[model samples]
Target: LFSAVVAPFLLASIPMLQPDLQRATLNALLQISAQLPVNQTSAGISVTYPPEDAWLTSRWPLVINMLWSLALVIGLVTAVFAMLVKRWLLAFQQKRDNTLPDDVDGFREQSVGLRKWGVNLIVGLLPLCLHFAIAVFLIGLIPFTWHVSKALGVLVSTLVSVGVFLYGLAALLGHMVVSCPYTAP
Candidate 1:
């Protein structure tokens, strides 16, 4: 009953809508929108940007792009490595089961682990390489730092280098701890 009355009222009012009321409502909406935000698309969609921080807009995208590319490369490499590992595992299993000849290598495997090859190849090699690279690059800066301020620079550089090394070592240890549960071929 409520819907029947309200639906007819809405239909009748829509056809007989007052132009003055429509103009006033539109004007109010325009005023509100004008005060809302400057950033928007042509279709009146709102866009947002970092406020009060021009530095973040410039540097964040660069760092994000660098990390994205690194991750992409690492993922591709890991996928390939996983494929190889799957093949090796299949060949190893087949040889053990007497289906594959003992003289053939792992690369000659006909049936690799098709269902979960990607998961099985958890090499944990990329993070290790990145950590070591970061440690080496930071530690290698000690000589340049030594020239800037004799004692303070050397001390700071030494501390930073040691911290980076320990961080990398910890990361390596963590990787090994995680990976030790899974056996490799």
Candidate 2:
């Protein structure tokens, strides 16, 4: 269910995970310091310079793409894990027509053991993958926001930091508290 909701978002983000070639070209062209004024007047013309292009030249794109790639892989792995577990459970639930004398207790124990392992593994890892993917996406988003707007970048970075911090706190609490209901990987 969670994968159904998140898969679309992860897939949709594929096109946006690329570096901006136009921006990169413009940054390259703007590297020259020497330039003539576009307009001249007897009173002297004023020229405005754009903000530093360091962000474009830096490795932010590579870092962002790498993070997105990791998130995508994690999402795919989680989806596959979910499907495998579901199939296994369904197989276990299927009726068997064996008429030979069988030990009910042994069959029950085997079934229960397999079911417990599958359920525990899925429960423990699904949320962990989701949280990790979100964190990676948010981390990648900081550089993207920075490219769009510095104020927005700051806002996003702060919010993401807070979110990650809270997630870490929750995980720690879950580990420390025996009665905690939250699942942690």
Candidate 3:
């Protein structure tokens, strides 16, 4: 029973972690770059690439690839979640319609339920709002930190934002489902 209640919250944290992970990767790459050697030639500057077998092994490129992978994962998961939620909502609405009697009282009852759902929806939106605020703060932090640290902060911030968004969305959908209108003949 405890697990059931906590499970959703835990799952919701995944999106929040996304930003942190991204920042960490970015910071790591920047830190690696800071160690690289650069020289000025007569025509231009030359920088020796790290050997293929080096531990840093194309750090920036690798980080870039990882970032792309993360983006793809986020997109795919969001799409799947949206599709499932849409189907579930449609099914729920249909069920409500079938259960309700075609009368004024039924309409009134459904309206009341809708009002309650609306309240829940608003409450659910709080997390999303908080997420946005945090993101804004993180953006502000970018200029204050060293290049590598700024990247890390950005990654952390992004994860937190995504987590909050996912959690808020799921909570809103759950509330809507539970508070959906149904009436008796």
lDDT (CA) for every model shown?
0.48, 0.68, 0.48
> Compared with the true structure, what per-residue lDDT tens digits does model 2 show for residues 1-185?
54454455446545454566776667565544235444564443444445645765577766776777777778778878878877866765553323224767656765687866768677567768877876776777787788878999999989988977777787898998999875456
TM-score for candidate 1: 0.29
lDDT of each residue in 91-140, candidate 1, tens digit only: 65666577545535543433344334543335456345444434333343
- Candidate 3 — which residues are off by over 4 angstroms? 1-57, 102-185
Tell me the spans in candidate 1 whose CA falls farther than 4 Å from its real position: 1-53, 99-185
Q: Global lDDT for candidate 2?
A: 0.68
- In candidate 3, position 77 carries an lDDT of 48
> For model 3, how big is the CA root-mean-square deviation?
16.0
Model 2 alpha-carbon drift over 4 Å, by segment: 1-52, 95-102, 105-109, 112-123, 178-183
Candidate 1 local accuracy as lDDT?
A: 0.48
Candidate 1: the clashing residue pairs are none
Candidate RMSDs in Å, in order, are: 20.6, 6.5, 16.0
lDDT of 3 by residue, 61-136 (tens): 3343333344334444444555665665576577568764766676566557756666446444534444443344
Model 3 residue 168 distance off true place after TM-score fit, in angstroms: 20
